[model samples]
Target: MKRKLRSGITASLLAVTACMALHSPQSLAARDAQTILKETCQGCHTPEADNALSRISHQRKTPEGWLMSIARMQTMHGLQISDDDRRTLVKYLADTQGLAPSETDGVRYALERRLNTVEKFDDQTSQMCGRCHSGARVALQRRPAQEWERLVNFHLGQWPSLEYQALSRDRDWFDLARKEMVPLLAKRYPLDNPAWKKWQASAPKAQAFVGDWNFSGHLPGKGELAGVMSVTADGDDTFKVSVKGQYADGSPFNGDGSAILYTGYEWRGNVTIDGVTMRQVFAAQGSAMQGRMFEAEHDERGLDFVAAKQGSSRLLAVQPGYLKAGTETEVTLIGSGLSGKPNFGKGVEVLEVVEQSPDRIKLKLKAAANAQPGLRSVMVGSLKGPTLSVYSTIAEVKVVPAFSVARIGDGGGSTPKVQGRFDAEAWGKGADGKLYRIGVFPAQWKVEPFDDRAREDEDVKFAGTMQADSGVFTPGDAGPNPERKMSTNNAGNLKVIAAVDDSGKSLTGEGQMIVTVQRWNNPPIP
Candidate 1:
């Protein structure tokens, strides 16, 4: 009776185990595959503890094959198992876990879901091909069946772990995968397309100039004269001019020049020549031809000319103090004798020339009552092909000053000096509310180069500093920390401080900064 009771308990326990196995969740069963392999077959095949069952699951074979593999494992690998228990486990695996027809269907369904279409390549082939190479690399090439076979053999040799050696055992499945991939790749990324054609078409065109221009013309022996002129245009009818030039000779012709023009049926432009000022006009002739030119103040000795073109590219007449705005009407005036001339005391001369539709001319002059009023005040003018002619009474012109400033010191020096130099003598207002002269000893200071080159010579060490009129200097932040104040280390070795005008006040501001320089060492000979 005691033995019978013990047998009953044993039978009950077996029934419970079977019930648990059948009722377990899919996730639990998946985990059980790993757990069973670990607990039962991990002794001799220690490295295969976790991977053994995974390898088996990826292989789809008949029930008999599964049993045979397990039998081999037991005999060859010394996995100890009773015949009855082994038979029961084999039956359980074959019935509940063997590859079913649904397994292939599920794999196909997953591949379709991931790729969004039916593909020539199976999921396994897609993964293997994409691992070390791009899909386009294979798709772009067309190959015969033999070529593809050779390609596969080459890959098998390159990456032996892909286990192409086992292909014989799974020849049918591998062949199916390969055949699917080849055609799918070929269709998606074809070799011929319009994008390639477009790229081939556009590769060469020159660029236009859109910046400042510096030009100069000088007389022979007398002090050399230089002039600066800038040209800019608006939509189709307006143009602006700023002319600043100087003569080395001490004459009445030296002074600042300026003009403004508007275009319509006729065009109008104003100009100041040597110390003489005048206005002129033009009418459009089918093609828009409008621009202005001024012979250098000392051009009487020789033809030193400066011309700017806009609206049209036609070359107008060449004459001293000639101003043309449009295409038809031209005005002539006299610069001297303003004292005897009506409204001449104001040093401005007005001349009425033939009026063409849309063209207007006006003149202005500034002179002293005691000044000599004769041929020096009269301006003679005429028109030639595209060029307006003007005769100036004043022959010699004075020089206009051009000045530039530079800073020199240690990158972070407490006291910084600005050295200024002028082509000619210059007297100008400084930010300090004091009058300053360029090139003179008292007004302009000479700066010597600093000796910080040892540390500041690096590309990263160069930097500049800025200061405000309030005497406060704020250094900017550097690096990723946007809110932190800029540091010396964060700045480059070299520094420059410049006086910048902001909000009507002259302030010191930081200029460009350099950080550290990167150098590469040569590689050793192999």
Candidate 2:
């Protein structure tokens, strides 16, 4: 049977090429049909064959059938023929390679043989069975024929959208596949298989959790708040905790940061909560534990926090600091300065010691009120000694004065230019310790117009002078001082030269007065 099948396949393949030569103009011109058949088709099909293709050919299919067969080969086997070549090849094959009744058996046998080899049982079986489940999962199941059939039927019916068409169109193929698959599964993945048994026995169990907690705390000027917490089991060792409560004034919490509860309770494994999934590791005492928390929803915003059980209660201590009058200072307070503790009001009493006289000290108390008074303070201090007592008190606040100018503009003169002066009292403290007063006058000057309109007039001339105290001069003697020039123009821009004193030295230093041209204004005001 095998020899006959192989021979039939060989003949059918030869006949295919023989038909191609008879029709193709390119091949027809150089080679006869027999030569094309011998070279291209004999490798796979022969004259003395019993293949599926030969059997179908023997039945005398219509022209359309021959065309379909040729089209299937071109599409499946990368037959690089143009459309016109395909039509020519198909016509020749139908005319010259038509099969007789006596050859029908050989053709049918060849086709069946080819079908068996081409319709892969392993690949199709694996793909179909693995659509909704693992291959190993299906293989591990040892079911009787009826049970297997029922399972296949259930899959086809249950997933009407997935397996219905395959089951209906290729019912025989599926049956044959199942027949081959069942025995292989029964032999290799029997119910008694150790690996299969182990997997079934060792599947992870559901998580579990325990206990409830409550917290009541004060939030400085924000007032009092309380929260309730409860833990529940997820699976074997995993647990989920739910927390809900409100602020002092009774506002409902919402969303993840609000009232939503968390589900991360993976004691021996991991759990996900409030979009924060975590792997949990327990401590020996079972009271303390640590793990990394991943932000499931916002993966980029993940953070880690430690959780511990004290007695029957759980405490979550985040970084602590004070938000006072727009100032955020992180200072730990001891003794009477502790805020939000029992008995203390919502404010702190700050004691300031001022110098009433050289010998006498004056005490001034500044009281800050809030929900929990003693907890927050400007300065938290501690006194170390025999008992090592700790305490915090308000520190004396210093006020630094800032300087401001009162006016600035042109001092009308022969130069008809820009000039202005600043208020001495507003200038504030200088390096001399005492409040210093300073003034500036036009020592030198020049002027430019508001627009390029004045640049057109080359004869227009303007000039003035300006003077300023040494206090207003920048600290360093860096030459390119921008403030030195009162105005600018294309007249190579104005230049200011400080006057020489009686000693024939430049008066550019210390408490000295120097004069230079300042600037000019056109069309002086009345």
Candidate 3:
């Protein structure tokens, strides 16, 4: 199995590829997809005893995973195929061998391009398999013990230095990987499962996502935003998408795009707004959808989004859910089937109804100076669980990501600079003296040396500059800078600071930021 999968390949040369978007399988297209896969993969992934492709049929993975497999074949092996046929093969294999929703629970971050995540796993899997890449790459697949063992041998063969690596040199890596890791992985992530069987028999159709959807999300640099996403059926398992929304700062966030659904629930969209193109990756389930919308060029800059279908009575979230005591402001509730009177709990009064629709409702609400200061549930008709916070003062301010990394690039180079985005999360002390979240608040941003080493190296002066209004830290150019003491380029360690004015005092929050170099080996799932 290892030889069949790794034929004519080096581990270092298995480059990543673009993700896949699939159409519903028809008899004719299905045959074509299978023929393409067989013609391209049969050379090395030869027929097995059961007449199945040896290595390919023994495992299951995500669409991104499947794409990576094919990409490795193209990059290392001598497989020659057209772009359309490759796309067809990917769609076919992913639809047939994709993991069920439950199996993908903790590993979706890999597919979402959230590369900054820190993963914690058991020692056996982490050191043996994921020392060179993300542990998520391992968790995103399902294989029997035989396949897992073969994969271990392939790693040893393709990368001859596997035994000389740090973790390998410390232990019997090959022996442990074959004997212990194989059984452990097979037991933990077996190829055949009840969930996959059920999903294959009754998967949701792409047409289920048609019509309008009310969504809410928090962009790292841009505060909270609420919007309406309109998805129209453009073809089989594809959509024409458009979104119109406003940030908490009143800036417009609108876009027009097209989307293609893969494996029923994987929704991928490419949208252009004011000429800038962005991509949206979402998972549609029931009457709700959740995902990320990111810049096509800078995938690191994106939003965490959640939305509800226009017909459901589900109350998703309250926009600007926090209100200052003694102030009246217009707040919007994002959801579906909104109706009846709006309730802001006690000590708060609904001044006037600004707008109303099945998707969203806007109202002028006032919180009295002596109002209860705490989290209160906001209910409307049958919608009963969303909360609103009334705060008299902010007790503390915390940066969203306590630690992050920013890369230097784009000095007329291919890789763009990865910005370190942040949001100032406010916390208020309620009457009970317990602290509760007051959502994201406006703040002034700056950077400073995090420690004596950073100060001595003048990291604050050389690493990057922070955007005052937007908590965005843009790193300096790629390559070494002659101005530095050691000519070490812009890479440095610094502290991100966000200062929020609360009542009469300034509340500050500090987070660590590491300015680093470009990521040259960016895989599809990394």
Computed on alpha carbons, the lDDT of every model, listed in order, comes to: 0.31, 0.30, 0.82
Residues 43-136 of candidate 2 have per-residue lDDT tens digits of: 5545555432322223222122354445445534544444445444444453333322222222221211111111222665555664443343
Model 1 ranges off by over 4 Å:
1-126, 133-153, 164-174, 203-526
Score candidate 3 by TM-score against the native. 0.91
For candidate 2, what is the TM-score? 0.19
- Compared with the true structure, what per-residue lDDT tens digits does model 1 show for residues 223-295? 3333434445532223444555555443333333222211112223344655454232222223332222322
lDDT of 3: 0.82
TM-score for all models, in order of appearance: 0.15, 0.19, 0.91
- What's the true lDDT of residue 291 in model 3? 84
